[model samples]
Target: MAENLPAGWSINGNGAEKSWFRRFEFPEYARLRRFLDGLAELAEATGVHPDNIGFGKDYANVSLTVPSSEEEQARLGDFVSRLDRLFEEN
Candidate 1:
């Protein structure tokens, strides 16, 4: 099943070669940490892993760079949507 993304999620950075960025605010760092591992797993399961994650005390800075290939872009979109929904549940 495809996950739903939250409103106002925007694309940042320039060019497909550069990493993509999204900012999300969660309840707390502990909860965020717990969920991120699961989220990373999902990314791997789908074969579209995030490049790096910056965890703040209460927020997350996610950066992903899927290849320009159509399949990778699709998978990347799916990953971001899932993350958007996961945030809602937490």
Candidate 2:
């Protein structure tokens, strides 16, 4: 799971509860809102939603579960990469 995580993301917990987490910060609320909206759209399009998403006016904390299967791990890696792209685009 550590190998699959993108830069700026960290792993938490152990066993089945293990997850990848990242906190994104924005300069302003509007930018944060746009990022959150894009995240929602990405989740819908990819069907790889985060396990938990918590946000304030200028930051968002995203957590995605670590799947046990190798196939799922690959998908998660792809998803995490796309998420990084989305953040850059926003």
Candidate 3:
């Protein structure tokens, strides 16, 4: 499934782990904050939140997982696609 993820995203752990994660880097704190704020708004509107969102002055880490069911996998894939587009646009 990791092979199906968008560029810059990858599996967080080895075999049996279902989570995917990506770390986004910014040149400064201001840009990082703005990016996170936009991501938060998207998450709220979509109701598909990351399992974890961590950030420092220059980077943000977003992680997510879908349950084992096929429907959940589809939903997660859509959310991930949205996230990738948001990152690119921002």
lDDT of each: 0.71, 0.89, 0.81
lDDT of 3 by residue, 37-57 (tens): 888887898787998999988
lDDT of 2 by residue, 1-90 (tens): 346457899999989998999999999999899888888998898889999999988899999999899988888888888888989988
For model 3, where is the 10-residue window of minimal lDDT? 10-19
Estimate, for each residue in 16-87, the C-alpha lDDT of model 1 and write its tens digit: 555667777777777787678778788778877777887877777888864677676677778877887777
- TM-score each candidate: 0.75, 0.93, 0.82
Candidate 3 displacement at residue 28 in angstroms? 2.2
**Whole-model lDDT, model 2:** 0.89
Q: What is the lDDT, from 0 to 100, of the residue 12 in candidate 2?
A: 92
Q: In candidate 3, residue 27 scores what lDDT?
A: 84
Query: Which candidate do you rate higher for TM-score, 1 or 2?
Result: 2
lDDT of 2 at 6: 71
Candidate scoring better on lDDT of 1 and 2: 2
Per lDDT, the best of the predicted structures is 2
Flag regions of model 3 displaced more than 4 Å: 1-3, 14-17
